[model samples]
Target: MLVGVLSDIHANRIALDAVLDDMPDVDAMVCAGDVVGYNPWPAECVDEMRSHDVPTVMGNHDRAVVTETGFGGNGMADAGVRYALDVLDDDRIEWLAGLPESRYCFDGRVRIVHGHPDDPNRYTYPSLFSARLLGEEDVLIMGHTHVQAHERFDEGIVLNPGSVGQPRDGEPTAAYALVDLEAMTVSERRVEYDIESVIEEIEAVGLPEATGARLRKGR
Candidate 1:
C-alpha cells in the first residue's frame, strides 16, 4: 500500500491544497500533527482533512488550542493559537481535542506521533534515533520540527514529511512524503504554492505578520 504522510499543516489552506494536488494517489494518508496553528484558514484546513477522512494525531498546537493552554512562546505564537481557536467552531475544536496523541497503523507496522513516542509534545530530533522509542515497529513517523527527514536505523525506519503549511527547512515549498509499504521505498516531495496569497490572508485576518513573512523565507 502507498501512504501519503504529512505533518505540521499549520492551517495554511493554500499550501495544503498544493501538496494534495501534487501528491500521487495513495491507499491512505496520515498527518503527524499541528493541523492548525501559525497561519490563517484553520477552519478550511481542518474541514479539508475531515472531508478526506485522514487519520491524524493530536499536535501540540492542537492540544494547546483545545485545552486552552498557553503556547509559552513569543506573543505572536500565542496570538496565532488564539486566532485559530477563535476561528474554529465547537465541532472542529472537539475533533482536534479528540485526536489521539499517537496511533499505530498498518496493523502496528507503522507508529505515528506528533512528537516523541513517549511524549506527544516533546521535540525529538530525527538525529536521535532510539531503539527504545521505536520498540518493535517497522516504521516510526513523526513531525514537529518542520523539517523533512528520512532515516534508516538498525531498529527501524524514521520518516518526517516536514511541514505542509509552515515549512522551516529553508525551502518555501510545501513538503510531504510517500511511503510504499509493499515496495519498502519512501520518497520525499515538495510542492510550490502562492506564498503571497497565504501571507495576504494572514495579514487580512490580523494574524502576526511574521507568521506570513516566514513562509517567504521558509524559516
Candidate 2:
C-alpha cells in the first residue's frame, strides 16, 4: 500500500489545498500534526483533515489549543492558537483534544509521532534519526522541525514530511512525502501555492504580518 505522509500543516488553507492537489493517489493519508495554528484558516484546515479522515497524532500547537498553553510570549504562535480557539467550535476542539501523542498504523507497519518517539514535544530532525530510535515499526514518521528529510536504515526508515503551512527549512514550498510500503521507499515532495493570497488573508484576519512573511522565506 502507498500512503501520503504530511506534517506541520499549520492552518494555511491555500498551502493545504495546493498540497492535496499536487499529491498522487494513495491508499491512505496520515499527518504528524499541528493541523491547526500559524495561519488564518484554522477551522478550515481542521475540517479538511476531518473530511479526509486523516489519522493524526497531536502536535505541539494542537496540544497548545486544547491545553490553553503557549510558547510563552511568542506573539505569532499565540495569535494562531487564540484564533483557532476563537474560530473552532467545541466538537473540533474535542477532536484535537482527543488526538493521541503517538500511534501505530497500517497494522503496526508504521509509527506516527509529532516530534520524537521519546517525547512528542521534541524535534527529531532527520540527522538525529538512527536505528536506535526504531523499535519494531517499519517506518518512524516525525514532524515538528518543519524540515523535509528522511534516512533509510537497515532496521527501518525515519522521516519528516516537512511542513505544509509553516515550513522552516528555507524551502518556500509545501512539503510532504509518499511512502511505498510494499517497496520500502519514500519520495519527498514539494508543492507551490499562492503565498501572496495567503499573506493578504493573514492581514485581513489581523494576524501578525511576520506570520505571513515567514511563509515567503520558509523560515
Candidate 3:
C-alpha cells in the first residue's frame, strides 16, 4: 500500500494546503502530529486534518496546548500555544486533547509518533535513526526534528516526513514524504507555498514577528 506521510504541520494553512495539493494519490495518510502551533490558522489546520480523517499522533506543541504545559521558555512556541488556545474552540481543542502520543495505522504495519518511540518530546534527528528503533512494525514514522530523512534496515524502515510548517531543515519550502509500503521505499518531497501571505497573516494575528521571519529562511 502507498501512504502519504506528514508531520509538524504547525498551523500554517498555506503550507499545508500547498503540500496537500502537491502530493500524489495514496491509499492513506498519517500525520506525526502538531496540527496546531506557531502559525496563523490553527483552527483551519485542525479542521483540515479532521475532514481528511488522517490518523495522527499528538505532538509536543499539540500536547502543550492541551495540557496547559507551555513549551518551557521558547517565546515563539509559547506564543503559538497561546494563540491556538485563544483561537481554537472546544471541539477543536478536544480533538487535539484526544490525540495519542503514538499510534499504529494500516493494520499495525506502520507506527507513527511525534518524536522518538521511547519519548514523544525528544528530537530524533536523522543521524539518530537505526534498526533498533523499529519494534515489530515494518515502518516506524516520526516527526519533531522537522528534518526530512529516512533509513532502511534489514528489519524495517524509519522515516520522518519532515515539517509541513516551520521547517528548520535550512532549505525552505514545505516538506512531506511518499511511502511505498509494499516496495519498502520512501520518497521525500518539498513544495513551495506563498510565504509572504503567511507572513502577513502572522503579523495580522499579532504573533511574534520572528515567527514569520524564520519561514523565509526555513530555519
Candidate 4:
C-alpha cells in the first residue's frame, strides 16, 4: 500500500493546500498531527484534514490549543496557540482531545506517532533518533520540529514529511512524504504556495509576527 504522510500543519491553509496539490495518489494517509497552532486558520485546517480523510495523532501543539496546557515552546508558536486556546469551539476541542498520541500495530509493521516512540514530548528527528527506533517495520512516520527528511534506520525506515504549516528549515514550500509499503521506499516532497498571502492572513488574523515571518522562510 502507498501511504501519504503529513504533519505539523499549524493551520496554514495555503501550505496545506499546496502539499495536497502535489501529493501523489495513495491508498491511505497518516498525519503526524498538530492540525492547529501558530497560523491563521485553525478551524479551516482541521476541516481540510477531515475532508481528506487523513488519520492523525494528536500533536503537542494540537493538545495545547485544546487544553490550554502551555506545553509548546515560547517562540513563534506562542501567540497563535494562545489565540486558538481562547477561541476554539468546544466540539472542535473535543475532537482534538480524542486524538491519540500514537497509532501502532496497524498492519502489524507500520507505526505512526507525533513524536518519538518512547516519549512524544521529546523532540526526536529522523536524522537523530528515528534511525534507532524504526525497527523492522514497513514504515515509521512522525512529525514535529518541522524539519523534512527520510532516514533508513537500522531496523526499517523513518520518514518525516516535514511541516505542512510551520516549517522551520528556511524553505517556504510545504513538506510531506510518500511511502510505498510494498516497495519499502519513502520520498520527501515539497510544494510551493502563496507565502505572502498566508502572511497577510496571519497578520489579518492577528497571529504572532514571528509566525507570519516563518511561513516565508519556512523557519
lDDT tens digits, residue span 17-53, model 3: 9999999999999999999899989999999999999
Q: How many pairs collide in each candidate, listed in order?
A: 0, 0, 0, 2
Residue range 1-219, candidate 1, lDDT tens digits: 999999999998999999999999899999999899888888998898899999899998898899988477577678879998788999999999889998999898899999988888788776775666686788899999898988776777788889999888899899999998876778999999999999898889898888888899889
Clashing pairs in 2: none
Greater-TM-score candidate between 1 and 4: 1
Q: Pick the candidate with the highest lDDT.
A: 3
Q: lDDT by residue for model 4 over 54-154, one digit each (tens)?
A: 78899988988767766455856678777777767887788888888988645667788888877787777545855567655667777887888887755
Task: Score every model by TM-score.
Answer: 0.96, 0.98, 0.98, 0.92
All candidates' lDDT scores? 0.88, 0.93, 0.94, 0.80
lDDT of 4 at 14: 86
Q: What tens-digit string does per-residue lDDT give for candidate 2 at 87-156? A: 9999999999999999999999999999899999897877788989988999999999999999999999
Q: How close is candidate 3 to the true structure, as a TM-score?
A: 0.98
Candidate numbers sorted by lDDT from highest down? 3, 2, 1, 4
